[model samples]
Target: MASVYHINKGINRPIVFKGFVAQYIAYLAVGLVLLLIGFAALYVSGLSLFIVLPIILGLGAGLLLVVQRLSKRFGQHGLSKYLARRKVPAFLRFSSRRLFTSLSRGGIIQ
Candidate 1:
């Protein structure tokens, strides 16, 4: 008798669906959920189906397009890296040299 083992080829890879990778899937899901809630709220508020439907549908479509574009542009981790880059200052400023002086003495100023 001979036995064979199956290997998982996708080990250590990001989850991808319909060309969306990793967190982009979650972003699309959350956007859809919010659109659903908006539809429900508008319907309950006595808005006409004709009005509510088109508005929500348009928003949902826009959300899909935007998310897809972002995923394509940013890959898996580039979005996060971009946001982090935005948080970094262009140039750090220090009014005093006390910080360096203390470091040379082997102690922090604060």
Candidate 2:
């Protein structure tokens, strides 16, 4: 028989935000790659500049939003709780979820 394991505990550590800043920069780099790819596709397909511009902008914004969320989820232990105690909005809780997925997919904070 084989044994399997799962992680069910939280870690207690300090988050300096330094690493996350680096993570965000990398995310932005990916965003640029996406933009360039969009542009290349449009050029190859002979599509109007106007048609591809919105699609590129939308992709970039979506990527930016994802990076922001990821930083939050990877914050140091008790960081978010401290923020909530200071009256951080309820919407941020949901934002954290989106960020977690983004960071995981982007291979930044995970």
Candidate 3:
């Protein structure tokens, strides 16, 4: 009889696609969606292909470059962390002592 074992690694395993991994795949997907939307909008607005094509190409290329940089700078979950971090206040003031002193002075409790 042979014993079989299964190992459960963490959920942080990197996703690989065509030699790219993790955040890079997400970056590409987001860039592709934005590019499609931009080109479709331009086409529907009756813009000539001569103008729309260049604009779309230029914007898509620039956006992909930006995404590549972001993916490189922040690994998997970096974008989420960045968005979450932005919501935090830069300076949090805690004055428990001051609050207690003020409450004591208010005479609410004898």
Candidate 4:
């Protein structure tokens, strides 16, 4: 008798939902949660719904647009790469060659 094993086709793939890939989905969720919290706070503070609703709605729309644009532009790992690249210095400053000159051909300097 021969047996067949089933393999998951999605192995090692980034999770995608409605055009959101990987971390973007989490970003959107967190943004929405923050918007909800802001709405509730504003409402509890006695602000008119007419005032609060449009503000929250506009923020939510902006958040969605920004997150979607980032997801599309940066894909999965590009955003982290971009952020790390930003942290790198444009040029290293070496005052002198003494650090390099101290190194021996066969061994490191004490």
Clashes of each: 0, 2, 0, 0
Score candidate 3 by TM-score against the native: 0.61
Worst window of 10 by summed lDDT in candidate 1:
101-110
Model 1: lDDT to the true structure: 0.97
Q: Is candidate 2 or candidate 4 better by TM-score?
A: 4
Give model 3 RMSD, 1 decimal.
4.9
Give the per-residue lDDT digits (tens) of candidate 2, residues 1-110: 99899875544433234455434556667778878987898878998878888888888788777776666665433444666777955463463677667786886674
Q: Pick the candidate with the highest TM-score.
A: 1
Model 1 TM-score, 2 decimals = 0.93
**Residue 40, candidate 3: alpha-carbon lDDT:** 93
Count backbone overlaps in model 1.
0
What would the per-residue lDDT of candidate 3 be over residues 16-81, giving only the tens digit for each residue?
Answer: 665455867877888789889989998999999899999888988887777777777776778789
| Preferred candidate (lDDT higher): 3 or 4 | 4
- Position 39, candidate 2: lDDT: 86
Model 4, 1-110: lDDT tens digits are: 89999999999999999999999999999999999999999999999999999999999999999999999999999999999999999999999977777676534655
- Per-residue CA lDDT of model 1 for 1-110, tens digit only, reads 89998999999899999999999999999999999999999999999999999999999999999999999999999999999999999998999999889898888843
Error of 1 at 51 (Å): 0.4
Could you tell me every candidate's TM-score relative to the true structure?
0.93, 0.45, 0.61, 0.90
Model 1 clash pairs are none
Global lDDT scores for all candidate models: 0.97, 0.67, 0.80, 0.95
Q: Ten-residue segment with the worst summed lDDT in candidate 4?
A: 101-110
